[model samples]
Target: MKTNRLKKSLLGITLSVSLFVSISIMGAPQAAHAATANTTTTAASTSVSGKAGSIIALGKNYLGVRYNFGAQKGVTSSFDCSSFTQYVYGKNGISLPRSSQAQSQVGSYVPRNQLQPGDLVFFYSPIHHVGIYIGNGKIMHTYGSPGVTISDMNSGWWSTHYKTARRVIK
Candidate 1:
């Protein structure tokens, strides 16, 4: 039984790697920091709803996990802000940079009102934190106590330090 599970896991990983390699070869690699000067942008109406929902669903599954600052990437045990976003999005076949600052430069910017599920919402100046916007102004992110919980974007610290949002699922 264990050997069968191992074979299945290996097969799945091989397929995923093949797809990722093919996609990477077909597209030019762009620096995630290239859009730093632009900072925030306002765009709407192009994101695919299905992808966003899948991303959010994956993120929601991590609720109650502890927040470990500087957690190792790809580890399911615990997650830092960026690593959390990276893993959740990666599970849905999207690649995100490893830091909040670089991630803040991703995708076309969307205004707060225009944010949809799966949009990456950033917080604080210089981009110290990130969360997956799960619609209705709530964000699913890991931080401090009650890790990975969904919180309102319009209230408390998140509201005060609201920086910008990126539509990475587009």
Candidate 2:
């Protein structure tokens, strides 16, 4: 009788331990999967941040370039509004259309207040001009007067002509 009780008790303990082990094994994969997903997300975010930084740096470097109508596509000596935007982003591995109107349609629409460092900002009633946002409500563009210059978004001309902004970097 004692032996029978001992055998039953041992069987119960074995079963409990087996169940605990099975549960742990099942949970381990889920935990690992969650960790892998987090790692991938972090990596993707870092890549995007790096791209944005590159765009801003390019914009800053080309701040003094002159504006030219129908400027050469690959050269930086002169640029139209769209060409200026394209050149800045293109240097960072992002390709934009040759015209401002077309570039406006390429990215997710961003509200004016949420503009980031490398956002493409549009302007004018006919959507004829675009610029690169450089934070602090300032934008860098190749305007007729200043060539490539930084202007406040609230400036007389820009404030009236401001249309929308778009975020191309993902």
Candidate 3:
């Protein structure tokens, strides 16, 4: 009788320990999952903030480089209208196509009134010219008088040739 009782008692203890371990194993992952989620949220937020700051910094850095014709491929000293836009955004970690026409195809279409910093403001009928929106109804581009300068959207030249604006940044 004692032996049978001892066996039952041992079995009960072993079963209880197994259940406890199982519950702990399952519960541990939930805590870990919560921690992982928190980490991911923080990383995403930091990445977005970093990107916005980088874009603005890039815009400020390449303010006055001269415009070059057919100069969209490499990071040369001077930049054409399209090249200037590509270089500024590229420096901010965004890769754009070589031509303004090509770059315009990507991202959401932004209306003139909705323009923001880092947005690509396109111009000309054939879509040959492009510039970076620098807020306040002004765009930064290479004009004949100044290589890279800010001009109002309502400026006579830009107003006539204004095609579209696109937002490539998230």
lDDT of 2 at 78: 80
lDDT of 1 at 169: 74
Model 1: per-residue lDDT, tens digit, 1-170?
99999999999999889778745742332222122222121121223245665565556556788999999998766898999999878866899999999999978999988987788999998789999887667788999978778888889988999999999776
State the lDDT of candidate 3 residue by residue for 1-170, as single tens digits: 99999999999999889778756754554344334322211212222223444544444445576767886465545778877777667755688888889988988999887876668889988898888765556676775647877777777978888999998988
TM-score of 3: 0.64
lDDT of model 1 at position 20: 85
Model 2, residue 71: distance off in Å is: 0.7
Ranking by TM-score: 1, 2, 3
Sliding window of 10 residues with minimal summed lDDT for model 2:
39-48
Per-residue accuracy of model 2 over 103-142 as CA lDDT, tens digit each? 9999899998898777899998779899887667777789
Model 1 accuracy (lDDT, Cα): 0.76
TM-score of each: 0.71, 0.69, 0.64
lDDT of 1 at 75: 74
Off by over 4 Å in 3: 1-53
Error of 1 at 168 (Å): 1.1
